[model samples]
Target chain A: DVKVTQSSRYLVKRTGEKVFLECVQDMDHENMFWYRQDPGLGLRLIYFSYDVKMKEKGDIPEGYSVSREKKERFSLILESASTNQTSMYLCASSLIGGDAYEQYFGPGTRLTVT
Target chain B: TQLLEQSPQFLSIQEGENLTVYCNSSSVFSSLQWYRQEPGEGPVLLVTVVTGGEVKKLKRLTFQFGDARKDSSLHITAAQPGDTGLYLCAGGVLMNYGGSQGNLIFGKGTKLSVKP
Candidate 1:
């Protein structure tokens, strides 16, 4: 069974504080993604990493950064968490190639920056 | 920006009811995928349609890709409470994936509720 685990399911952070959301995949997939889901905006991609130390900015990567030091681990970092940054964060992983590759996601972390 | 739009943002119905959700886009896609997400969880891939005018079935759920490759629909024969979830449609473009998962544009998603 494929499993993606996030560091926290719920988190509260003070404004201007640094926050880190960790995601680990047991499948060792080559591609990992970070996304923030909002009420009406759907899922906006933050950042994605295809391999160790290689990353790409997604549609909404402005306030977030990502690190992938290992194939199974991808981390999302918020340098200065603000009230507007509070949202549900999702992490996903997928195989690199082949036909229609699908992403497998973790349970998600609901962060509230106050 | 390739925008995929879904209609009827929210739907509530009783069990055994039939419903259809539509996903439309102006940009042609190499493939389209449907996913179902439960609360507090990430979306899970339900199906992917590659060929235009193709129809695929998974039990009571039916997925169709339009001939123009710019639209898709999901139909439920008999929606059960277990089928209640947020349905998301994503359009993908074929490219060199390399370390990247293929680029996919996602719709806002349709939230469905089935009550017993």
Candidate 2:
């Protein structure tokens, strides 16, 4: 089974503080993604990495950044925590190729900005 | 402008009941995947339909991709309390410029509750 692990299950940060969410996958998948889930908004992609040192912005990337320095780890950074940035953050990984269509997700991190 | 739309937003049913959820999109997708998310956990992939007019079944769950590749449906037979969760439908498309290989457009999700 593919295992995707996130650093924190719950987090709280003050306004204007920097926040980092870490994710690691044991499957060595080539594609990793970060998304924020909000009520009525669904899961909107924040950033994604296809390979080491390669990052791409998703639909909602304004308040977020990503890092992929290694094959198994992906990190999402919130420049300045705000009440609007509080959400359930999810990390997912998938292999490369047709069979990689399915993504395995972590247990998620619920971030609260105050 | 939600690219993917799923309905009904919430459903509550008794155990042994059957239910079907629909996902609609205006744009065609290369493939659509179904996921079930339990409370406090991220979504888990249940099935993926790549070919148009294709149907795949996992135990009591049945998934179908529309002929136009713009829509899909999930049918759960003899629903059990263990089936309660938020069902999400996602469409994957290859990127043209982004370094990412693919991006997924997801629906708001249908929250299902099965009571025994």
Candidate 3:
């Protein structure tokens, strides 16, 4: 079985604070993604990394950044946390290039910005 | 944006009942995937349909892809309480734009509740 793990299951931050969400996958998949799930909005991609040091912006990338310094870890950073950024964040991993067409997700991290 | 629309946002049914969920899109896709997500957990891949007009079944669950590759459906026979969860449909085209090939664009999802 594939295991995707997130650093924090729950987090609370004050406005204008910096937030970091970490993810690690044991499957060594080359593709990793960060998404935010909201009611009525579904899962919207924030950023994705295909390889170490290579990143791509998804549909929603504002006020967020990503880091993929290693093959197994991907991190999502919130530059200035705000109430609008509070939501359930998910991390996923798949085989290189995503040709496999399926993503294995981690237990989400519910971030609250106050 | 490749949009996937799922209908019947919520469904409540009794055990032994049959139900079907539909996912629609205006654009063609190389494939579509169905996932079931439980509370506090990530979505799990249930099935993937690639060929247009194809039907695949796993145990009591049946999945069908539209002939145009623009839609798909999931049908469960004799639904069980254990099948309760949020069902999401993701559709996307295959491209080589920096590892995004075959990435899934998702639907809002359907919350299904099966009571025994």
The candidate that achieves the highest DockQ relative to the unseen native structure: 3
Q: After superposition, how far is residue B58 of candidate 1 from its true place, in Å?
A: 0.8
TM-scores for chain B, listed for all candidates: 0.93, 0.95, 0.94
- Best-to-worst order by TM-score is 3, 2, 1
Estimate TM-scores for all models: 0.95, 0.95, 0.96
For all candidates, what are the clash counts?
A: 0, 0, 0
lDDT of 2 at A6: 100
Give the clashing pairs for model 2. Answer: none
DockQ measured for candidate 1: 0.64
* Cα misplacement distance, residue B37 of candidate 3 (Å): 0.4
Ten residues in a row with the worst lDDT in model 2 chain B? Answer: B94-103
Quote model 3's TM-score. 0.96
A9-81 in candidate 1: lDDT tens per residue? 9999999999999999999788888999999999988998878999999898888888999899999999999
Point out where model 1 deviates above 4 Å: B95-101
Alpha carbon lDDT at B95, candidate 2 = 70
lDDT tens readout by residue for model 2, B10-66 = 999999999999999999988999999998999999998999999999999999999
Candidate 1's docking class is: medium
